[model samples]
Target chain A: MEFLLLTEKCIWFGLGAAGFAVLFNVPPKTLIYIAFMGAMGGFLKAILMHFDETNVIISTLCGATLIGFLSIYFAHKTHCPPPVLAIPACIPMIPGKFAYKMMIGLVNLSGNIDHDTYTQIMSETVNNGLKVVFILMSIAGGVGIPLLITRKESSKGMRLRKRS
Target chain B: MIAPSPKNKEIKDLGNVLLNVGAMLLSSGASTGRTRNTISRISDSFGYSSDLLISHRTIMLTISDKKNDYFFNNLKRSAPHGVNFKLLSGISRLSWQVVEEGLSVNQINVQLSRLAALKHYPRWFTLLFVGLAGVSFCRLSDGDALDMVTVFTATVCGLFIRQEVHKMKFNPYICIFCGAFTASLIAGGGLKYGMGFIHEQALATSVLFLIPGVPLINSFSDMIDGNLNNAIVRGLNGFIISFAIGMGLLTSMLIYRF
Candidate 1:
């Protein structure tokens, strides 16, 4: 039942990725690559969800890094955009519910600023927000490096061509 | 007008060759200052013409003299009724062409560089994007009724709001809020009414609006074209946008607690 649920989720995500690609006018072959990357990312997210890790930061960072690597490879191989491939893949890893809960806490705290509850809610929100940022940064770094290097090499090639 | 000097003609020929090569390179996915320089050199080889070298679509070249007049005439036809084609020459023509074509690379670079650089987005396109997003949310929500009425209302509202707010030049923050609010209402209402798979199905589809697919693809193109700065900037922007969407959705969900 769990496997069936996972499969259904993966397929839905894949369909979502493909739909976005079509809407954006990405080529068919590139759309397939995006779908594959999204599925992989979703699978990773499912695995991470099962783990009993309390540290959201570390777990998110690791998950994002993996997605980033896979995204970069797919982007390079297919000559499609990394964001197109990576964003969908990383969707599952996004702390969407956590962030939402944090906002709720803030709103509730705002209504009644009793010291203890306020402090606790604020602390939790701040911590969760920071964790989200860290995960995003890691993903960015992982994806950004390959893109930078690839661009640098292409620029160098252009210069050489100009000199010749 | 005097006939151009022989040396000028040779330079012009070289320019033509280079520009053609550059355009071909760009079309084939080469993105560099070098390509622009090559095109520029070609443009400079011949005495500048208002119609031949630049336009709204691209910095096109007239390979022969006959084509030159045709290019200019096309521009003249396109220009506003009162504007005389001859009065507009040099950079002015080039810049006008860029506006006409939209801010594309190669053809519009010279014009784009000169403009005040306000971001331009079409209202219809934004409406379509938002409408699709709303529809996707409704479709993915894991319910039975599919919330057709809600989808229709949201689509119409999104279009109306986008058209009304488009001229205000507001930040994307507004769009994000609107998207989230609409998604939540649709989701909450659908789920509350026992709409079944409608809510679940819509989750995947609604999230499609936040997909950074285009930026990701453009990043690769920029990288391949050797525009590292452009590539990096684009990639970073995409990442931030995605993060913002995720954060926004999460926040909205918590506030309503649906």
Candidate 2:
């Protein structure tokens, strides 16, 4: 039931994304891909959030990498920018709320902290920070791979053709 | 490549402009250094002339002898109509290919003067305004009508102030801060007025403002074109822009308590 509910929510979000893309003058197909990627990214993030007992950063990294790769493949196939898909897709993975909470927590944290409180707060902050960075890195990696491949291929082609 | 006919020149020039704007937008929003590099590389591969690339540092392009007559003639025609040739030239350089071929410096200067006279805002302004609106909409979603209005008003005011300050050559950081501060005031007012829905709508709309559409497009184009560095750079820039907007909003909220 929860999975169904999540899937439904993702579809709605995807639709919203598609609408926005069209409204903004982007190609409809591009928007659809973005929406689909976003939904999947969100679902993966949610799954990680629910079942993963590992560090938040690790979980986020794993989830983002998985989603990002899928987004890249889709983007390549569609001849659209991966970030078009990845950025929206990663929207759900964004630690906006977590970052906000962390900011609030830090601001409210008294100077005096016993070991347990200090440890917990420190751990949480570190976890949230790492999660954000990890997610960002994942996005970078997803976009980077194709670019690198293309560059290598083109340069090699140029060199070989020059020799021939 | 076709021989440079008059019409061909115009078409090529237009293509260069589109490509340049697209590249810059992509580079600006990229999330990694690699993406920015990739865009530059891809742009080179696309055969953008060096002048377009160089003017990224200085907002000036040297006119070329080959294109001089054409550029000036067009400038003279546009000038009588209060159009600035320099601005057009600057805008023209948005593509490296056009820049490489050379353009009319004097005409472009005239265009800039005209543009200055017209007081046209930078393209980034529209983007910033739209982005703020999206953020405000998101915040207003908590169900506050007055809050929504306040955020809307504040965002507009903030954008106005930002434009004015930018005209005065204020620091970029200062401009961002002012924009965010004004947005916060609007958000707070919306909260005070009980316009949560308005705020939510603004926030939702604003999210699109930060949408790295250009960079994403550029990255994809670069990747497809086999220019990885350019693509990577564009992607990284997109991330930074998004992060900056998010941070600005967060800061505003923290300061305003709404």
Candidate 3:
């Protein structure tokens, strides 16, 4: 069951990413490559997180950095920009449940409530909201690594390279 | 009447080309740095120095010729931001062509039109696959077979509503609000009624396709690149959209008490 869960994580995340790519109108040929990258990143995160010792933020950062670097190679093969491939593939890593919980806490806290209840709700909201923020930052920070190093599009220097 | 000199006309033309490219890139999802770089590359290739002021929805460009001592300024209001990777990639390539070929302004304009006219993947394809994405998201959250069906149903309905509302020229926020409301209505109902063991997971992931993931990442990337103003504007935009989606979900939850 544990192994199955890990493997399915990869497949489902890949499908999710491919769906996202379609929504963004990525060219048809690139979808497979984007799915492959998404799967690899999702699997890496799943494995790291399953160990139960590593922090979620660290695991997410590693997954996203892997996606970021992979995007360069995949983007080269697909003939698209790196972000075009990387961003959508990273979407599955978003903190959806945390965001949902924070919103709910906010809504409940706004109504008339006792002091203890208010404190409890506030704590929950802060915890969930902070998680969402850090996870988002990690995703951005991790994926940004490749983008920073690449500087210019891979296609930019292809002609110059051939000439030289 | 003295005719304007050819050099003067050329500088004006260059300014127009720069505005068009900047507007297209900014609106079509290029980051601030890329848009600035592409504009500078094109202008430099044309022997003009360029400077740009890029805001949330407008680009102000200045072009100057050093020896001729000519400076021209142009401003254009960019279209609303949307995720279209094809346009982003297309314009990047076009920028390279401008530099490599020394293409005339008219030729670049022709190429821009061609790229703009390029068709997206079929609408039904996006709609169906987006729902599949929702299903995949549901599964990732540990949803079961029954929950997958529930999410698929909710997502297709939600996305269809969004597209329909968007096509009618409704504000994009309103479109997202409506989509979120529809998806959560169905998923919330499933959660309330216990449609499956994983129905809660379905409910959570159902409206997630509406999250502005691109804008969020773009904002972070912009901040890292030191475009602080653009970053703040984009970050705020992402937050507001998330809040709107949350409000829609809240409304559903209130109705269903889930």
Q: Rank candidates, TM-score, best first.
A: 3, 1, 2
Chain B, candidate 2: TM-score? 0.45
lDDT, candidate 3, at B112: 90
CAPRI quality of model 3: medium
Give the alpha-carbon lDDT of every model: 0.47, 0.46, 0.87
Report, for all candidates in order, the number of backbone clashes: 30, 76, 0
Instruction: Quote each prediction's TM-score.
Output: 0.51, 0.49, 0.94
Best by TM-score: 3
Q: Positional deviation of B171 in candidate 2, in angstroms?
A: 4.7
DockQ of candidate model 3: 0.75
Residue range B99-144, candidate 2, lDDT tens digits: 3443343343354344344433344544443443343334312324
lDDT of 1 by residue, B123-167 (tens): 454455445444433433442345534554544453364335434
lDDT of 3 by residue, A14-126 (tens): 99999999998887788998899889999999999999644888899999999999998877676677898899899888878788788889889888999999998999999
> Alpha carbon lDDT of residue A2, candidate 1?
71
DockQ of model 2, rounded to 2 decimals: 0.08
Model 1 interface CAPRI class: incorrect
In what order do the candidates fall by DockQ, top score first? 3, 2, 1
Put down candidate 1 lDDT per residue, A45-145, tens digits, no spaces: 55565574575555555655565677667755754434445554444444444544555565566675778888888889887667756665554454455
